[model samples]
Target: MPRYARSERQALADLFQTLGPDAPTLNDGWTTRDLAAHLVLRERRPDAAGGIALPPLRGYAERVRLRIAARPWPSLVDQVRRPPAWSPVSNPLTDELANTMEFFVHHEDVRRGRPDWLPRDLPAGLHRALWKRATALARVMLRRFPADVLIQAPEYGELSAGRGGEPVRVVGPPGELALFLTGRQRAARVQVDGPALLADRLRAARLGI
Candidate 1:
């Protein structure tokens, strides 16, 4: 697949400028400036990036992110627009693997944060790539879920996960399915097939990215 990360990076930079630094984002309590600063720190600061997942470092991570956010908004967003050459995560070699979903999800985070936003008309190749990644991620994120989950992505393939309970089938485009599985169920436009209560529970259940 073509490098989607670069395009998304540029798109988010543009959006940040368009909406202004005070714009809201789907990430609770984070403004556009906050999101931009987090992106900058993720690629540039190795010591704090682990806070995204590891609870032990979360405090440090937030402190570092806040410190970056305290800088001038234009400079921070520009840093997000242009990743440093030495950035381990944003450089050409790792950008595709590490930043595609990162940027895409965050792009949607900013998009869906506002009212009347619609899904992007993504390329087939990008959808398939997202499907491949979501499938692998589902194996892990859904492993402990209460119900047995089936993810159906049209023109791609399907992934069956979750521990054991009732079987709930999730039907959507690959990108939507990825969003649903990654803690964005409230925003993901997908059809859930199976019992009504089970479906509600599935959508409400905690999902890790």
Candidate 2:
């Protein structure tokens, strides 16, 4: 099997180096430097990683992350590219399960953040991997959505999400579906087929990890 996590990590790091520290990313207020620092903290600093998902720990996490972000750009990108063997999420046992979608999404966060960017031709294996995760993630993130949601990646598979109601069908490639489910709805090139108002609402909704 291909090590998508490793490949995506390296690609993202190279993009960081090419774009420099100040380049914009799909992460609203975060720059490329900020994203690199976040990746470093996520892998190396278990203590601060909690802040990424937990509200109460966020302040301290943000402090540490900001400090890390201030390091030299090349150093930050290097840290992102080479995960330490001792790190919790990036170690041999966990790296694939943990970072595949994480790195893929963040890679696109930078790639599609630019106006002139175009989608890449992803490998079929990676597409299948992404579809598996994207389905699981969609179920979680869309659990509260007011309508029944059916997500489809024609070459892979499909699944239903959201609270019970009128059905909404979302169709796209697995990678684009991943982006759509992860709150980058505007950036994802997916098709939503449902009630006009509901489809529009789905696009505008805050959906993510």
Candidate 3:
């Protein structure tokens, strides 16, 4: 997971650089300025009882980039050595994991928005780890849907389909599946194997971030 986070962060930073002026387009209607502001807001606002001020976006990204380039090995080690501070928003583990997932998912988001901004490359191990983590997170998110919908992914085999009867089929690669469930990827990534109407309804229900 530590390695995965490191790789994911690197991918995100690379995407940011590649996207350049088009970075904000990644979040559907949001502009690059909006995306930058969103990240800055997330970083500055503490989820815990007491908030710790985060550096500005420009400074934050510079720090992260320098940390990655100069001492990537030590950065991963440091993350393991130091626990993430608590946030008032959610569980630290969940939040941290989500942040990592956000990097990968948003990378796709930006790439999809700007076809010219392709990823240079992705580590094989990082992709596999993301697949595992995304599958687990998808299962958790699927639980909120009605019982009749059967959400299955060949990549992860049969997952807990929640309740029965209201069948809504969702299938795709782990990253696409995660983005689809999170309402970021609206494409036909999730196949409604059962009833299309149910899938439509599920799609209409906006899942919170």
Tens-digit lDDT string for candidate 3 (1-209): 35555455466555555545344464656644345434433443443212223333456554443333343333333332233455332235554454666666655666666655543354555545556666566566666677554545454454654556555666665555666666664642556555667767777666425
Prediction-by-prediction clash tally: 0, 0, 15
Work out the TM-score per prediction: 0.96, 0.98, 0.62
RMSD of each: 1.2, 0.8, 8.6
Candidate 1 lDDT by residue in tens digits, 7-123: 888999999989988999988899999899899889999999999889999999999999999999789888999998778898778888888878888898899999989989999
Q: How accurate locally is residue 70 in candidate 2, as Cα lDDT from 0 to 100?
A: 88
Instruction: Output the better candidate (2/3) by lDDT.
Output: 2
lDDT assessment of candidate 3? 0.52
Model 1 misplaced stretches (Cα beyond 4 Å): none
Clashing pairs in 1: none
Highest-scoring model, TM-score: 2
- Per-residue lDDT for 149 in model 1? 89
Q: Please identify model 3 stretches exceeding 4 Å from their true place.
A: 22-24, 47-98, 115-124
